[model samples]
Target: MADNDLEIFLTARNVLVELRLNLAKAVSAGYKKGETETAVKSLIEVQQAIDVIDHASEELEELDEAEHDED
Candidate 1:
């Protein structure tokens, strides 16, 4: 794989992990404080992170296909 593709993949994966951890923390804190809104917001953030990673993966796949076409 190209260096750029590898970097993008790694960054996206890391961001996804970060988001998951953040969501978990938010849920824990929210429960402790009895704040449902905070937990819901955290869930939304997790979904956004997932969408970003999915888009990055799709773009990488397209780039790979284009590169293969030139071979």
Candidate 2:
């Protein structure tokens, strides 16, 4: 648990939290507004957010492994 590692993790966590909140807002707004465009846009956003989180997870795992190897 180096300071750098902790900072990276917390930043990623915050980004994920924000992404989820936005997704929720998009879903709620799309449904309430009854717009097909909004629904499709939300779907795109969901995929993009998932991809980002997935990549971040992989990167973090690699970082963890590298840190352990150094020790």
Candidate 3:
């Protein structure tokens, strides 16, 4: 990957990490406040986001490998 692309990926990954952490905290607080339904919904969304990130990261790795093979 080009340097710029790598930088962008890193920045996105960092933002996702931060978001995940914040969501976790929110979930914890929601549960403590007896907002079970809302907390569960948020948790599900967080899981979905993580899944998308994982899929995208895997696709990128595959593309990188293919590029190396072509080289």
Measured over all alpha carbons after superposition, the RMSD of each candidate to the real structure, in angstroms, is 3.0, 4.1, 3.0
Instruction: Report every candidate's CA lDDT.
Output: 0.75, 0.68, 0.69
Global fold similarity of model 1 (TM-score): 0.58
Error of 2 at 26 (Å): 11
Best by TM-score: 3
TM-score of 2: 0.52
* Number of the top-ranking candidate, with lDDT as the measure: 1
Instruction: Report the Cα lDDT for candidate 2.
Output: 0.68
Better of 2 and 3 by TM-score: 3
lDDT of 3 at 17: 70
Superposition error at 27 for model 1 (Å): 0.9
TM-score of each: 0.58, 0.52, 0.60
Q: Write the per-residue lDDT of candidate 3 for residues 1-71, one digit (tens) a residue.
A: 54456566667767767777776777766456456666667767766776776677777777778888999
Encode model 2's per-residue lDDT on 1-71: one tens digit a residue: 55476577567667766766776677666555556456557667756766776676678778888989999
The list of candidate 2 runs beyond 4 A from truth reads 1-34
